[model samples]
Target chain A: MHDGILTIDLDAIVANWRQLAARVAPSVCAAVVKANAYGLGMVPVSQALWRAGCANFFVATTDEGLLLREALPQARIVVLGGVRPGREQGFVEAGLWPSLFSLDAIERWLVATAASGTSAPCVINLNSGMTRLGMSPQELQRFIESADAERLDVKIFMSHLACADEPGHPLNQQQLTQYSQLVPAVKARWPEVVLSFANSSGIFLGQEFHFDLARPGAAMYGVNPTPALPNPMRPVVSLRLPVIQYRTITEPSWVGYSATVQVQAGQRLAVVLGGYADGLLRRLSNRGEGELAGHRVPIIGRVSMDATIFDVSAIPEAQLPPIGEAWVDMLSPVLDVNLVAEHMNTIGYEVLTNLGSRYHRNYVGGAS
Target chain B: MHDGILTIDLDAIVANWRQLAARVAPSVCAAVVKANAYGLGMVPVSQALWRAGCANFFVATTDEGLLLREALPQARIVVLGGVRPGREQGFVEAGLWPSLFSLDAIERWLVATAASGTSAPCVINLNSGMTRLGMSPQELQRFIESADAERLDVKIFMSHLACADEPGHPLNQQQLTQYSQLVPAVKARWPEVVLSFANSSGIFLGQEFHFDLARPGAAMYGVNPTPALPNPMRPVVSLRLPVIQYRTITEPSWVGYSATVQVQAGQRLAVVLGGYADGLLRRLSNRGEGELAGHRVPIIGRVSMDATIFDVSAIPEAQLPPIGEAWVDMLSPVLDVNLVAEHMNTIGYEVLTNLGSRYHRNYVGGAS
Candidate 1:
């Protein structure tokens, strides 16, 4: 972040973690820093959670595990996708635990560990219902038979919930039952290994889902895991862009690409330097609203590569800040990260991770 | 891109440029490689165009120009937003030609150039109508009086059209007239400087919009510069994802986040690893369609952050590919990038640029 464009509240992140952590009471809380902490700068985000007493961390790939290790050298880092061929050594070198999803992966890890003369740190991923990236019950049993789980240094046995976000969904109960049945089997084979199943949403699915560790990602960054309940999270990321130029378009002046919008009579249009390339979703171009000195400014034209035009005439007191000044005194009330996700017809994860790298990012709290 | 993830055809890119260059006929074609060649890899995209005889390239900011210079070492790189305070020195160090917009930026560039004991490379940007960036006609006159345009090493005098995409829109004519007036003024000051105007959309506005150089961005990547005409360009990028698992869903088996989708009796569902985080709009999950073994497959559920479920029950001969294998036997219909842009409520630029680093990108075509 080189422009002082966005200020991320790390305290908000810690507070959101505390709120989610409180719900799981006695269960240990883990931070999911996968996808660059959902695109909010993972190192800083995880450091904040670590200070807030987060002991465990989960990441999707080996690269992510390496990043987390660099940040939290003492924390237990679990690689969610397990070790792939040619990558087991990287995991070992980084002191990262690989999530074993297949018999082949386990066998490969065992071979790599033997080759390196090192005890392989491992986690077992069981497929409860989401038939993706996890070992099936049959596969797990076959693995246990072929290779002794007791011999391997397994750290955690985990399963993901497909419908944990929706508490009313029946599959959550079915997945809970299926995953729980495998837990005893896993524990019997490897009694020393801890168990973790819940993600951000699953952590909210009551104590049953919170086995031993709760891995919270989005909720820790302020998305409501339980939408039905009042949101316990405060927004952690605040995006702001500098107002490049301001112009009052009398009646006929048009704005932006394809002439998607026309300035009405007596409208003051403020052109912003940030555009879709800057991660201001083009769909939100004309449909969205921003702020200028607390005055709500309507985005009035098609967003271009590096510029968006907003109508500021409505705000009588709104003075266009100089070119370098951030127009958003705070986060735009009309812009929600989730809403941008929805507007892009994508999930919040995509919206977060896809955020442009051009913005000058500032963290208010945390390890920074 | 590994496993047929996403293929970028350099041929299509060069072909698009050649076609646009042909449309501009005698006008020298300049390519807009800003925003990292509209989110396609800038180095490769610009190199291809440069090989195809494009002499000029445009970027949004000075920083972009500085980085792009490493790729096209000898190419004439133009920084469209001009020199901001604290950035002009770096611009000079990188050998960038800045499009001078404001009086302050002009003065600063001159001062920096004098201080560095170098002739400053510059371009005069006249604000014909789009008040976003560039100097006004009045400012142009003032600039000529204040600065030594002859000694400034001005390369191109240009203006941007606000509504070139809409050829019928009168603003084009107004901007064209305003810009035409400044061309003479600019010529009077520096007759040797080349003239450039017309972005991707403006090129389609006929010969009038074209000058000594035409800078086209989206058109080079296959977006329709002229929406009224049949598309003369081919898409440069294609995204493909592997089907991780295929499962038999008994009546009412839930799929994906929130269990929003329920498989009916005898339905078959294939889970895909690519999701919104991979840059596929989540709305494309259940609402979009793909082709499996030449048979249409409708997506079956809400798109998860990392997975999507597709209804492959209709494809009778469908056999689930092993995990990590590209479901190439199932080819999605050739969807237009523009339509995908529309679906994502953004232009193709965002959709392409937002593509995550996780994707393995493969480029096909000649060095040009």
Candidate 2:
């Protein structure tokens, strides 16, 4: 193929979900399929998980929820980014739960459901020190007493962990304490509302963090949720880009855009078909390396918009594959996304989310 | 809008192309609409440019070339990334000009055309200075002698400038000299062939750099081709992400994942719906600022996958727009892609290319 192929192991994704589900036994594990399942095709990933007996799926917006609903008719679809006042009917009509982060949101949801003449559920986002998207404790207190609050049915009391990845971060315990305080009062009012406390990292923060339900996203997709420890999940993604052109450095030459690096004579450079535009982040320019013929090859100079160059001088000349037949590994088990994330000066989630759309995506080993 | 709206100005794009076309007067201005027109809709951008007297269009691959072909049938489309051996028929059928960078690629093209029994055109990429792609000076000599080469219709002799953005980078003059030396021989061999040089920045390197045709991509998309001076191109993109939630810090509290930043008492924050997954590069965390109610709101902590929080304390509480009513600017006329590119520690092209797929894409002022 002229373009790069992004091989997504759907069986591994299913296996990862099963492992997480098994870990948080009795506590239902939801699949967070937000950001197009972190840039892996959402429809396929969610379908595979659903086939594996997973029921709950979380998406960031109404559009994502709607798309996932089409793929999985009976699965519980929740829109984490709350549906707007006008947009409430779509969520209600579709039976999709929109997370209500404020009293105003809850009030509107109650009104919308009443007008629709049918009651639907929602996920109430509590501000458990995340300080991001959620209702404050003061607002939660007012919500508890409000007469209109009784009309609303919040199925999930979800509060995202702020520092769940860092097991030792004080905020993890602090957030747990704050969230735990409200759980009793919230449980008393809702009675059967599912308490979802742990995110991907929170599950690894121990059983205390996993309350009634756990939604682990990244780790299920092969990101090391517990970064300090060895990865427990199977590698779920691998990328291979075709080496379009290879040339021998007959003379000392400055390589790629801006003349960033000088390559000496006798060096062999192979230009691959992927670049920063393809989610091979610009920070991976010179610092990144890839697997080739069981040997490591270093990327040289700046990565162009459509291509990245690799120094393949280490490969024996006779062993070098012909121009069109050679394909280089950008992400194998050895050169995983975590290592790429380190070179990118970002996290594993950002790496997964940024994987570009130009690749020929191949989802393997899923139910046909 | 619940999701971030990426407002693309097709009128501005046309205006930018016209301005560049005027700068390199008498030289044909080809539009490089690869990478989905630098993440703006390619079909709309190319159709608009084609209407504005652009006779030539350039794309990165056969797929992009074919997509553009379906949109604009008459316009010349050149695939910069040369077509592979088995993929020649599709390019041939689509009438797409695949750039042949190596002698091997040219040989395959010769065979493919021979098998198909049709004579189509191609662009021959020359290695002038950018050692990333194209053929060396010696390879050109070898190509000239080969009997198979003469059978192929080489319509354009194209070479890229490595340091055209930095007119003073010395490689510009060196490349121009090398390219100039080969042009006469190439013209002698294929007299009807168009001699092309200069990228977006090359047009600014003075008239001499303009040979016969100049394909400028970045400046046409509002990226500052000339970084040393004020941007000559009109702004072509504006992004407004809706504020999903607003919260006040009642105590000294940490923010977002990793607990990267802290806010003191009485400070207000607005969480926008767009995040690193939406092409808001994580590098913008803490360092990036946005416009809200004429006040600069600095982004606090790390940018999450589906949201970014901006410290909105500067905006008086009384003036704060009701939760969903307010929208913050990530890229505007004042906060252009070039500025965002600077904050991302990369070029403007990347900022444009990395713009995510989740946004509600609004193309304004294009032909109906």
Name the top DockQ candidate.
Answer: 2
- Give lDDT per model, in order: 0.74, 0.89
Candidate 2 residue lDDT tens string, A1-368: 54888999999999999999999998889999999999999999999999889999999988898888889989998898897757888887789999989877887888888899987589999988988999888789788888877888889998999888899999999999999999888988899899999999999889998999998899988998889989898999999988889999998899988999999999999998888889998898898988777788999999889999999999998888886778889888988878878988888899899998889999898783
How many Å off is the CA of A83 in candidate 1?
4.2
Q: Indicate the residue-level lDDT of B300 in model 2.
A: 94
**How many clashes in each structure?**
7, 0
Worst 10 residues of 2 chain A by lDDT: A84-93
Q: Report how closely model 2 matches the true complex, as a DockQ value.
A: 0.77
Candidate 2 collision pairs: none
lDDT of 2 at B334: 91
lDDT per residue as tens, model 1, B1-368 = 13226677888899888988898888889888888777778888888877888878898876688788988888998887666667777887888998877776677788899999999788888777765676757767876876465557777899888778778988899889988887877777777889888888888888988998998888888776777676667777777766645565544556666667666768777665556656666656567666555566777777666566788887663454545543632222266677676555555666776666656667889475
